[model samples]
Target: MTSNPPKNPLHSARLSFRAPESPSDDDFFSAMVSDIDAYMNSNITNATVPGSKQAKKYQEYLTEKTLLGVVICLRSTHVDGNESEKPTPIGAMHLCKSGDGMTHHRSTEIGIEILDGFQGKGYGSEALTWILEWAFRRLGLHRVQVRAFGWNVRAIELYKRLGFTEEGRWRDALWHDGQFWDDVQLSMLEDDWKQRAERNLDR
Candidate 1:
């Protein structure tokens, strides 16, 4: 019988982040689209249906413009230790410049989406840690920001716990589920990230 190869090494305790080779990772992108809830669709992107033209277009745009785009994968180890299976892509995260010119050169916006099955598993936090390190240290960015619906308490809490601070809020900006929700803006400065790193080292 043929034996399988070992698992991919670019992984944390249970999650991995791999670069998207092209916009054609249809399976990965479709999985994310299928798992996004209505509220998330409203706040993140309007393309909800998998394999739709809009979704494909957006995927292409993201891959083409992304400074960094990663496919979030789940790793599994074999019992016998003979071989491990390849990680399965469960979601994605992207970091892109906010705009052109020197004024926006030091700022980037981040976006992330994880499938329903992988939620609440610390995978998002792990991915964020890796992305933030790349953003501040590798890419030499000064500011990183994300937007979330006020009703997305889970995401807001995660961002706060990771040292992001609320920068602003747009009142009743998003209309979803027959009600309006605030659009909350949160950001972390390079200095703040440095302080966080120092604190972690001390701990």
Candidate 2:
């Protein structure tokens, strides 16, 4: 099982995060691939693969991206003398760095997609916080950015509540679901993530 941690979970309090353990891992396939509901509001305007060809599509995705992406999972319950049970996957997240060499050191964009069944249960928030910490401290990134559609007030509000600043809005940048919507850009600097309360952005 080749994975980021191999056997251990990533740094999340209520969930497990790790690289895909296998190409055929059923849990991963269901949560990240076949789960159309999870991607409903995500706006996959750049998707290159058809829904039915997910396995190959996923492998291509892995090969094409310059980033650290992880499968988010529910921590497995430990049983007597059986602590090796695998966690159940629930979603995916990533920190995609800039492809431009000049900008690689200081910034990355984050994306979080939770399963429809798993949304709004604090799991996303927990995962986001841990990733932000990793971005600033572990990756030494100067800024971590994220984007949401203007209509996705829930996601934007969550990002703000967690310390991201509204950076800009691209007017009618994305045409989705029959209407053009603004792409709302937001970001958090290293200092902002570290001194959120001091900046009054953590409210």
Candidate 3:
């Protein structure tokens, strides 16, 4: 008999998280690349700014990194049609370790992107919350950090609402559109997550 695939981690509502099993699954590669490009190019002051190299090579990069356990893939899913239907990928979140050995074991950086039509529907928040829980609880991490472009107000707001505190801003770190944008860093510590959990219990 064959073993079953791993079960997905369910979130508060519709979103679910799973590992990407294959690069050939249901337009996953193309869709993910498109989402990355769309996110990078959105709200730009100049139309000619190029997308990141990672966006161009996301398939090979994600596959290799994920297999090496340097990155945890959070494939966000949602059900459609009926309960018998398999959930579809709506977005992806990734938590990447900073380096090898015990020195970097307690810290990780997170990145998330939701498909264009799926933004602002609470999916991003749910996905982010689930990943943070996994990072701190399951992985026993001391801190989780994320960086967002300065002009991405919506993303910055979501990060703040989810208990990440502003660590610092790298002045004019990203050159895009006709001007440079600050790369804002935010982080949540293990203590911070515990406090947020307590507040939720109190609610």
Candidate of highest lDDT:
1
Q: Candidate 1, residues 71-135: lDDT per residue as tens digits? A: 88887778764228877777788897555565455888888877777788898898888889889
TM-score for each predicted model, relative to the true structure: 0.84, 0.80, 0.77
Each model's C-alpha lDDT?
0.77, 0.73, 0.67
How do the residues 75-162 of candidate 3 rate in per-residue lDDT, one tens digit apiece? 3344642344466666666777455664455788887767776777787888778888888878788988888888788888999999
State each candidate's clash count. 0, 0, 0
Residues forming the 10-long window of minimal summed lDDT in candidate 1: 38-47
Candidate 1 off by > 4 Å: 1-10, 22-24, 38-51, 78-83
* Residue lDDT tens for model 2, 1-203: 76554433364655777775555554455446556645655645534333646645563554357467777777755554233566767777788857766665688899888877888898888899878877887788998899998768889999998989999999998776678889999999988887874565646
Off by over 4 Å in 3: 1-12, 41-56, 66-82, 102-105
lDDT of 2: 0.73
